[model samples]
Target: MNTNSNLNYTQTGDYLLPNLTLNQPRKPLGKYGRLRRTYLKEQRPVLYHTMLLNGSLYPHLMEVEQTAENRMQQTMAQLLKQNPVPDKEQNQMAWVQHMNSLKAQAEELVLNELIYS
Candidate 1:
């Protein structure tokens, strides 16, 4: 049996099979992470496979999720600053609607820039 770096091999018959395992902790993925995973698996299989083989998929997904969530917050704050909504005390429904619109727009921006791309 031959070994190099972090890989271990088992010999069976005439071939050596390398053992593969993920060293990342079992952390729960956020919504954006799942979305990015689905997009990569379906639309970008080659890149997905490469990342998986190299053991960087989960870390990349986590980074994307965190970045997307932060971007969403920043974008929502900027949008709210530019387009102020009516006070919640004066018009609760209007405030809710405007906030929902901002959230949707921010999500779209994250999806376009991070998940799908």
Candidate 2:
């Protein structure tokens, strides 16, 4: 007599951290699972920020909240003004690209400060 044993496992958040959190689930986990998918957990920050903005921060920024793009552009302009290219013959494209990267960094800094503050 010969017997065969097989264990087929379905990953139901077994690989997830104990403190993992998810804001939205892409699909229902079905009746067979309790653990939420990681893809669903990836967007928690956006959802959490949305909730914060909608709940307590809404009325506070009703008048003068600046868009992220605008902030970035402003930062870029400042950087350009401070570090303008030497002349029209200089590497204009490279200068512009560096300034744009600086702008993105500034924008990230702005976002982080706002979120953590």
Q: How much lDDT does each candidate structure score?
A: 0.91, 0.45
How would you encode candidate 2's per-residue C-alpha lDDT over 1-117 as one tens digit per residue? 112433233445654222323333344333112211122234455654664444532322321133434555677677777876544457777766776677667766655543323
Clashing pairs for model 1 are: none
Clash number by candidate, in order: 0, 0
Give the clashing residue pairs of candidate 2, or none. Answer: none
Quote model 1's TM-score: 0.86
Residue 76, candidate 1: alpha-carbon lDDT: 94
**Which stretch of 10 consecutive residues in model 1 shows the poorest summed lDDT?**
18-27
List candidate 1 segments past 4 Å from native. Answer: 1-6, 11-16
Task: State TM-scores per candidate.
Answer: 0.86, 0.35
Give the C-alpha miss distance for residue 46 in model 2, angstroms.
Answer: 12
